[model samples]
Target: MSDTETLNKLRGVISKLARELNTTATSEGLTPTQASVLGLIVFRGPLGLTELAQLEGLNPTMLSRVIGKLTELGLIQRDPNPADLRAIQVESTEAGRELSDRIKHHRTEAIAACLDQLPETTAQTIINALPALEALAQALRSTHN
Candidate 1:
């Protein structure tokens, strides 16, 4: 097959994978954006509004609305930033932590199921490619700045 044909097939696979992840998360009661924010917290720990906005590649106002909704639902909490004085840091509450874990477990199970269908060699290839995938993601993020 031509390179273009190969790329097109990969694109379809990526879209399907993304949608599967999204559906799995949605089944756990979080929109994609909310899930993304929760991921930032779980991965990077607490951050100020501006920092979270940058981390999520979103506008502060949009992040604020998401944070507000999460906070209203008792999933997250905001506290005064001691260092910044004027800024507030957002962190997951116990409920948020539990919810995040549940979502992660759901995603893990879904992915494990998909991997189970793959040949062992293909699954190993994916495991080996993870570091490169992470590097590519970092490079892509840097390019935006």
Candidate 2:
């Protein structure tokens, strides 16, 4: 395929995958953004509001709203940062971690089922392209930042 065609195909695949993941997350009572926030907290331990907003590429107000909802659900805890008493840090509660795990499990299962239906060679091709795909993602993220 031409470069344009390849780009279009990649875009389509990525968009579809995002939609699928969002649907799975929503079914678990979390919006994609909330799920992402929980996952980040689980992976990174804790993050201040400003840091989390930058990481999530969301404006502070929007991130605050999502954080409020998550806090209300008892999935995450917001505490004053000891080092920076003025800033609040957010971390996943036990319930949040469990929910994040469940969301991850569901997403993995869904992807695995789809991959299982693909021919071995095709699946291997995708596996082999992972590094390149990751690099592309990083490059995109850098540009966004």
Per-residue C-alpha lDDT of model 1 across residues 1-145, encoded as one tens digit per residue:
4599887986688788878887766886788899889877866778888888887888878898899888998888899988887889989888888888888888899889989999999999999999977886787788987
Question: For this target, which candidate reaches the highest TM-score against the unseen true structure?
Answer: 2
My TM-score estimates for the predictions, one after another, are 0.85, 0.93
lDDT of 2 by residue, 34-115 (tens): 8988899888998998888889888988898999999999999999999999889999999999999999999999989988
In candidate 2, residue 110 scores what lDDT? 90
Give the lDDT of residue 76 in candidate 2.
93
Give all candidates' CA lDDT scores: 0.85, 0.91
